[model samples]
Target: MTSADRLWPFLCPSHPDHDDQSLNPVAADAPSLVNLECSRVLVCVAENDLLKERGWLYYQELGRRGWIGVVEIQETQGEDHGFHLYALGNEKAQDMIKRLAAFFNREMPPLL
Candidate 1:
């Protein structure tokens, strides 16, 4: 199955047989993230991930659309999709977890 198919259950409205909306962000409009209140965005992508380029494109698009907050990406070299989840003890994973914690603890400045 494709990545979108795998993500559908998590990111989209449920299929005809399922009615779970708990995991959905409830945002019908996602491409236009102008309404997002967060001041900083962090996107992490493995070097060989299926969505690597797409993640970068998303960051660039956010900038193109005048995102006022800082946008950062942590590209894990020589890794595949979901590497951190499966390789929890790996150095890259540890670093990523630390970075994520730091990002979460950071204070967000007012949007530009």
Candidate 2:
């Protein structure tokens, strides 16, 4: 973890004051993570993002959990956080959008 993550000054100033178990859903005491009303989960992590490790941790923990749902992670190599937004028409961004549409409901219908 970096200094900003540890201190949480920029993102969430009061984060350090909060309990770690509650702050991090992947914490050991966070059984509530398995109880969210979602039926499926798709964690998208960009390879060079600062939060990539956290994304992987969430994906891994949720998979091992006995929750009655599906969980998986997709890593975009050589990309940083919010790359999809910046490169809206890029191949990986379009692929991620398709995956997200499927995750929310059905596969996106053909554009034609």
Candidate 3:
């Protein structure tokens, strides 16, 4: 297997029925919490990360459904998936860290 396949587990482990072709399947068939609710959502996604795109979508869906008070998306340019871990000392990683800190420090909307 290629490096990407080898690293898939660390990035996002595959589920037992992930191979099934379903658009909006039951929560039990998916890897997400049922009736999940959070006061704030901080999403850090690498711009060049394919895996993170799905996470971005999930957060967007939460925002659309008004389930999250805040949604933050940090797109780290010139970095791939797991850049923070693999691209330590890189400018992109440093920028991502700064953005994360800023997001955490900012005031969030009151929980609904």
| Number of the top TM-score candidate | 2
TM-score of each: 0.70, 0.75, 0.63
In candidate 3, the residue pairs with backbone N, CA or C atoms under 3 Å apart (3 or more residues apart, or in different chains) clash, namely none
Please write out the lDDT profile of model 2 over residues 1-112, one tens digit for every residue: 5532765444566556323554466665566665766676788989887667777877887766655567778899989888888998999999888888777885434322
The residue pairs found clashing in candidate 2 are none
**For every candidate structure, what is the RMSD over all alpha carbons to the true structure, in angstroms?**
5.0, 6.0, 5.2
Candidate 3 lDDT: 0.60
Tens digit of per-residue lDDT, candidate 3, span 41-100? 677777677656555766677655545465666767766778887776988777778877
lDDT of each residue in 36-103, candidate 1, tens digit only: 57788898899888667667876776677766778898999999988888988999999989999999
Model 1 RMSD vs true structure? 5.0
After superposition, which runs of candidate 2 have C-alpha atoms over 4 Å from their true positions?
1-7, 17-23, 28-31, 107-112
Q: Candidate 3: where are CA atoms >4 Å away?
A: 1-14, 19-37
